[model samples]
Target: MRTLPSTGPRYEPPRPGSNGASPFLPPLPSSRTPIDPPDPIEPVEPIEVEPPPEPERRKLRVVDVQDRASLGGAALAGLSLTWVLYSRILPTEGTLGFIVCWWLSFTAFYLLLTGLRRGRVVLADRFAVLLAHSGAALVGIALATVIGYTLIRGAPALMHWNFFSQDLRTAGPLEPLSTGGALHALAGTLIQITMAIAVTLPLGVLCAVYLTEVGGRASRLVRSVVEAMTALPSIVAGLFAYVVLLISFGMRLSGFVAAMAISVMMLPIIARSSEVVLRLVPSGLREASLALGATQWRTVWSVVLPTARPGLATALVLGTARGIGETSPVLLTAGYTTYLNLNPFSGPMTSLPLFTFKMSQSPENNYISRAFGAAALLLVLVLLLFAFSRWLAGRGRSGAR
Candidate 1:
C-alpha cells in the first residue's frame, strides 16, 4: 500500500447539464479540436499506349511475271540446245526422241535457272510442281495422240451409215466399207453385258453390304477372296467358265457362257468398289439412325445406300468398263459369229472387242478399217454409258439433297 501511486487517472462524475455517461469510460473526442482532413487525392494522368504493329501481309501468286520469264527463257534455251545436239551431236532421228530430249533438257535448264534465282526450299517446290505439270502434259499428249490416230484410221469406215445397221454375215474380208456393219457384235455385246450385270448387281451390292455393315471373320475371308479375284487374269476367268460350264456342266458355248465369264470378272470389281463407297458413308448417319430406334440393317438400307448411290454408280461403271473391253474372255466363252443372234443361249456370239480382233487379223485394208471403226465405236459406246451413269448418279444426288 506504500502509497500505491495513483494507478489510474482520477474518475470524475458528470458535471451538471452534461449528458449522463459511464465514468469508467474514456472521455469522448472534443468536437472543437482541429482534425486534419485526408490528403486531397491527385487526379491521375491517363497513360497513352501504342497498339502493337500490324503483321506484314504476304502476297501469294500462282505464276508471276518473273516466273513466266524464267519458264520462257528455260524452254527456249532447252529447245535450241536440243536442236543443236540432235543435229550435230546425237544420232536420234525420231520426233518422239527429239521431244524426250527436249523435255529432259528443259527440266535441267529449269532447275539451273531456279537454283540461281531462289533458295533450296523454293527450288525444290518449283521442281516438284514442274514434274507434276509435265506428267499431266504427257498424259494429255498421249491420250490426244491415241484418239487422233484412231479417228484418222477409222474415219473411212465410220462415214458409211450402213456400217452401224448391217452385219458381217454377207460382207467378205475384201468387201467395201459400205457393205458390212457391227450390228451382230453390238447386239451380242449388249446382251452379254446385260446378262452379266443382271447376275452381278444384286450379288455385288449384298456382298458389299455384308462387308461394310456386318463385318466379321467371314467378311474378312470374303474380302480376301474378292481382292484375289480382282487380280485374277482375264484368261483365267475365261478358262474357269470354260471348264465349269462348257466341259463339266455340258453347257454349250454361247453369249450366256460369255456372260458367266464376264460376271466372274465383274463381280469382284463391283463388290470391292462398292464396299469402298459404302465405307465412305458417314458413321454419324448410322449412329443417328440407330439412335432413332432403327435397326442396323434398316439404317444401312435407308441411310447408307441412298447416301452412297452416286459412288455405287461409279463402281458399276468401272466394272462395266473392265468387262466390256475384255477380249480373251469373250473370245473363249462366246465364239465368234458374223450373223446376228438375239438369243444368248442359242448360237455363237461376238462382242465389239472380239469383232475388232477378228477383223484386224484379215490381211485387207477394208478389214483393218472396219477393226479401227469398231474400236472407235467401242470408245464412243463407253463414253455414252459413262455419261448416262453420271446423269443417273446426279439425279440421285439432287433427289437426296
Candidate 2:
C-alpha cells in the first residue's frame, strides 16, 4: 500500500518538567514522561535549560561598615592632636586654626585607613572627593559665622523703625537710633542704582548680542575693552567721573555723577555675563529658526533672548550687586550728604556704603551700631533684588511655556 505524503514534524507531547518547573514543587513522577519509540526520520530535539542568575554586585564604599569603630577612634585622635597643637604645642590662639588642623588630620587618617583596606587607587579617589566636600563645608561655615556676627551686632539699631525711614543727616552720631535713620542714604542708593540699571541694561545687552551673534573685527576690539574693564579699579571709575564732570566741566557732586561711575563699573559685568548666557543658548534652536526662513535678528529676539532671559536677568542682578555695594565710586562722585535728594543733577547724595563709612568713622558707639544696621539693610536690599529677579525670571519662563 502507498503511504500518504509527509506533512512536517509529527506532534509529540512535552516530557514532564521539560517546561521549567517551579522550584518549590516536588519532582514530577517518571511514569508521566512518554516512553513511546520515535520514528527513524524524526530526530530527538534537545531542550535548552537556562543556568541560574549570578548574585548582585556591591559598590566599593569609601568607609566600610565594619570599620566604623576605627573611624571614630581616628577622629578622636585627630581632634585631640589639634587641641594640643592649638593650646600648648603651637603658638596659634584661634579655634579656627584648631578646626582646620583637626579636619586635615582626620582626612589624612581616614585616607590612610582606606588605603590599608581598599588600595592606593581607591584611596586617591576618596581623598579627592573628601577634600572637595571639606572645602565646601568650610566656605559654608565661614559665611554663616560672618552673617551671624553681623546680625548680632546690628540687632540693636535694627530694632528701631526710625532707622529704616530716616537719614544720618538729621541724627547726630551721639543721637539714638530712634531719631536719625539711614533713609536718605537708602533713597540715594535706590536712585543711583535705578539710573545705572536704566542706562546699563540696554547698552550691555546690545554689546553682548553683538559679540555673540555678530562677531567681527570691531567686536573683538570691543570684547578686549570690555574684558579689560572687568579688572578696572573702582577708584579709577570714581576718578574718571570726577575729572570729566567736576574738574573739566565744573559740575557739582551729585547722584548723576555717581550713577555714571557705577554704570561704568557695571557695564562690563553685565555684558560679559550676558554674552556667556547668550552663548549657552543651544545652536540647534538658532539653526532651526533660520531654516524656517526667520532672519537672524528675529530668531534672536523671538527664540534666543526669551530662552536666555532668566540667565540674562541673573547677569543684571549680579552687576547691580557689584555696583550697589561699592564705596569709593559713590564717595568721590556722589559726595556725602544727610538730606534726601531726589534730583540726580544737584546736591551731594550718600549711599549705604558711604553712610556706613561715615558713621563708623565717629568715636560714638551709637554711630557704630547704626553703621552695622545700615550694612544689614544693604544686605536685605540686595536680597530683595535677587528675589525680585528670580520671580520675574520664573514668570518669563512660564509665559514662554
- Each model's lDDT comes to 0.88, 0.85
Query: How does candidate 2 fare on TM-score?
Result: 0.75
Model 1: lDDT of residue 290: 99
Query: TM-score of every model?
Result: 0.77, 0.75
Q: In TM-score terms, which candidate is top?
A: 1
Q: Candidate 2 — which pairs collide?
A: 166-181, 166-183
Tens digits of lDDT, candidate 2, 1-401: 33344455675767545668975678765655565756636433545556668677776654567467656866888888888777787888887778778888888787777767877887678778878987899899899887787778888989999888776666776787778888888999999999999999999999999999989989989998898999999989999999998899999999999999999888888998999989989999999999999999999899889889888998898789889999989889999988988898998998999988888898899999988988888888778888988887777668764
lDDT of 1 by residue, 112-222 (tens): 988887889989999999999989998999999898888788889889998889989899987888898988988988999999999998999999999999998898899
Model 2 regions more than 4 Å off? 1-54, 79-133, 282-300, 387-401
| Residue-level error in angstroms, candidate 1, position 127 | 3.3
* Poorest stretch of ten by lDDT in candidate 2: 40-49
